[model samples]
Target chain A: MRVVKKAEDRKNEILDAVDELFGQKGFDGTSTNDILEKVGIARGTLYHHFKSKEDIMDALIDRYAVRLIDGAQEVAADKSIPIVERIIRVVMALNLSGGSSEQIMEHIHKPQNALMHQKIQKVIINGVPPILTEIIREGIQQGLFSTPFPYECMEMVVIYASTVFDDDLVVMTEKERSSRIVAFVCNVERLLGAESGSLMDVMGMFGEGDESSRD
Target chain B: MRVVKKAEDRKNEILDAVDELFGQKGFDGTSTNDILEKVGIARGTLYHHFKSKEDIMDALIDRYAVRLIDGAQEVAADKSIPIVERIIRVVMALNLSGGSSEQIMEHIHKPQNALMHQKIQKVIINGVPPILTEIIREGIQQGLFSTPFPYECMEMVVIYASTVFDDDLVVMTEKERSSRIVAFVCNVERLLGAESGSLMDVMGMFGEGDESSRD
Candidate 1:
C-alpha cells in the first residue's frame, strides 16, 4: 500500500524527527543518517526540504520562535486575567522548560550550541518585548502602571533578565539566584511604576518545585 | 648598540604594536609577521612573550579591564564630586570611545572580532558593578537613592546598557537612541529610588558633539 503525504506534511515530519534527534543526540552529535532512520525518509526527501543540517536547525529555530511568541500573545490577549497576573502569565508562557521542550532546552544549553543559544536570546529580546509591551500599555491605561516609554522599559527589563539569568553568562549559587530573583521583581515594579509588592507574587512563579520556574 | 629592555617593557611594546595593527587591519587581517615586523622582535622573542595571537588578546583584555576599573575607581573615590555626579563620572570612565582607544573600539566592533567583543563585555559586566555599587551605597546613605539591592540594581543597569547600546546587538536611529537614553536615565532613577530628573544631566554626556557620547 502506497501512502502519500503532502510536501508541507513531509517537511514537518522531517522537522519533527530532527527535533527529537537533535534534542537526544544534540545538533553536532546526531548525523543525517540518524534523522533519515528516525523519520523513515529517503536522503533525497530530506535534502529536498532542507539544503543542509544548518538549514534544518534554522527552520527549527523559526518554529520555536513562533511557538514562543504565539503562546505569550495568547496569554497577553486574555482580558479575563488581571493585568498584573496577565503580565506574569505572559512571561511564564515564554519559559521553555518542562515537558517536551526540556530536551530542547538541554540541547541548546550545551556549550557547543552557543549559536543556537544566542539565536533564541535574540528572538526573546526582539519578539517577547512587543507582546509584553501591549500588556504594559493596558496596565498604564488602567492606572495600574505608569510609563511613557513602556516599550523601552520592557526592552531594558527583558535584556537584563535574559542576560543576568543566562547560566552561560553569569553563574550564580542557589542563594544568590533567589536573591537576584527577589531583586529582579522589585526593580521591575519600579520600572513599570507599579506599587511595591504588587508584582512580588510573580516571584512565586520562580520558586522551587514550580514547574514554570525550571528554566 | 643593543638596547636593554625589561621583560615587562618588551611585552608592552609588543601589545602596543598589535593593538594598532588590529585597529587598522582588524584582528583577522593583522598577522603575526606584521606584529613582529612592527615591534622589531624575532619570532623566538615574540613566542617567549606570548604563545599565540589569542594569548596576546587575553593579555590586552586584562590590561584594558585594569585601566577601566582603575580610572573609574579614581573618580569614584573623590569626595569633592557630588554623589550623583560621581556616579555619572564612574560610568563615563568605563567608556572606551575617543583618543587612542578609538581605533581599538573600531577594531572590536568588526563582525569577526565577536569573541573579543564578548570578552570585553564580560569584563564590564563582572568588573564595573562593584565600583558602581559603592557609589550607590553612598547615595543610599545620603537618601539620594534607596535600594535593598544596590549591587543587584547596578548589575541590572550595567547589563542592560551594555547589551542594548551594544552596536552588534540592537541597532537604533539617532532619534531612537536619544529617546532610549532618556528612558534609560528615567528608569535608572526609578531603579535607584532617586528623584525624577536628577540623572538627566547625564544625558549631556551622550549628546551630539560630545566626545563621550561618540560611543
Candidate 2:
C-alpha cells in the first residue's frame, strides 16, 4: 500500500515538472527525452506515469483549469470580504504571474497553440461568469451594484481585460501603464455599480518584474 | 510624366494587394503567387513594388503604425470634445473593426509576425503618450483636470483601456460588456478630475457595434 502511494506521489511530481517544461519549451520544442533527462528518472518510469507527451499536456491543461476555477471560487465564497476587494482578488488569482500560469500562458501564445488558446479562453469565459455572478449577487443584495445582467457583464469585462491589458498585446512605459490602470479600475467600479474610484488598489498589482530576470 | 505616374500607381496597387492578402492568410500561409493572383499582376510587377515577401510585410507593418498614429492624432486635435469622448475615439481608431486597421491587426497577430506585433506595440507605447498627453494637458489647462502627471496618467488610461476594452481578448455577452464600459468611463472621469457620471456619453460608444450591428 505504501509503495502504491509513493508511486502516485511520483506521478504528480512528474506531471508538475512536465507542465512547467512544456509551458516554457513548447510541445514541439520539448522532447520526451528532455522530460526524462530533467526528471532524471528512467524512461520506463516516465512512460508508466504518462502514456505519451499528449497525455501529459492534457493532464496539465486540465489541472491548470481546475486550479484556476477553484482559486476564483474560494474568493467568491469569502462573503466577509468586501465585493470590490473580492473582485480584485479574483482577477489577481487568474493573473498567473508566477507558478505554472506563466508557463501555460507562454505555451498558449505559441502559433500552433492557437486552438488551445481559444479553448482556454472559452473555459475562462464560461468559468468566470458563475463565480463573478455570485459576488455580483452579493453586491446587489448589499445595494452596492446595479447591474441587470451580472453574468453577461462579467463575460464582457473578462474578455476585454484579459486580451487588451495583456502585456503581450501592447507594451508601454510604466508612467503611461500606471495611468491606464487607474482608467481601467475607474471603469470597473462603474460596471459593478459601485461608487466611482473604487477598486483603485488594482493598479498596484501590476508589478514591475525584476529587470535581472529578463536580461 | 504620365508613364511615370502610372508606374507609381501600379506599385501602390501591388502594395495594397499584398497587405490585404497577407492580412487574411498570414505571413507563412501567403505566397508571392497568391499576391500575383489577387492583384492580377505579373510576377515582375510584384517584385518591382517589393523585393521579397518579407519586404511586403514590413511595408504593411509600417502602414499600420502610421494609420494608428494618424487616428489617435486626429482624436487629440479635437480640443472641444470631452476627455472621455476623446479617449473613446482614440481607442476606436486603434480597433481593427474594418478597413486598413483590420488588415494591420490580423497581420500582426499572425504567429510568424510576433516581431511585428512587438514593434507595433512599442510604437504605440512610445507614440500614444504625446497624443493622450495633449488631451490631459488641455484638460489641465482648462482646469477640468488636476493630475500632476498628465502624460503618465493618460498613458496608463490608454494602455488599460486599449487592452481591457478591446474585443479580441475575451468575448463577453453584451450586457456584461456594456456595464464594463459604463464602469470604465465613470472611473476614468474621476481620475481626470471630472465629476462622477460626467463621462456617461462614452458608454454610448460601446453600443455602437453591439446594438447597431445586431440591429
Top candidate by lDDT: 1
TM-score: model 1, chain A: 0.84
TM-scores of chain B, in order: 0.87, 0.75
- RMSD in angstroms, all models? 5.3, 7.8
User: lDDT of all predictions, in order shown?
Assistant: 0.77, 0.65
Q: Model 2: which docking level applies?
A: incorrect
**Residue A7 lDDT, candidate 1, scale 0-100:** 82
| Model 1: pairs clashing at backbone N, Cα or C within 3 Å | none
Tens digit per residue, CA lDDT, model 2, B124-190:
7667877878777876787777665566455555654544454244455777566666665665565
lDDT of 1 at B53: 80
**lDDT (Cα, tens digit) per residue for candidate 2, span A1-215:** 11334777887887877766766776656788888878778788878888886677667677778877887888778988777778766765665354335545556665334434544665676788788888888888988887665765575467545554543455557765556656656655655667755466533543434222455
Model 1 lDDT tens row, B48-134: 989888899889888877876777778889989888878876665555343233444556655445456667777888888998999
Write the residue-wise lDDT of candidate 1 on A31-146 in tens digits: 99999888887788789879998889889899888887777788788899888888766665554342233444555655445455666767888898998999899899999899
Best by TM-score: 1
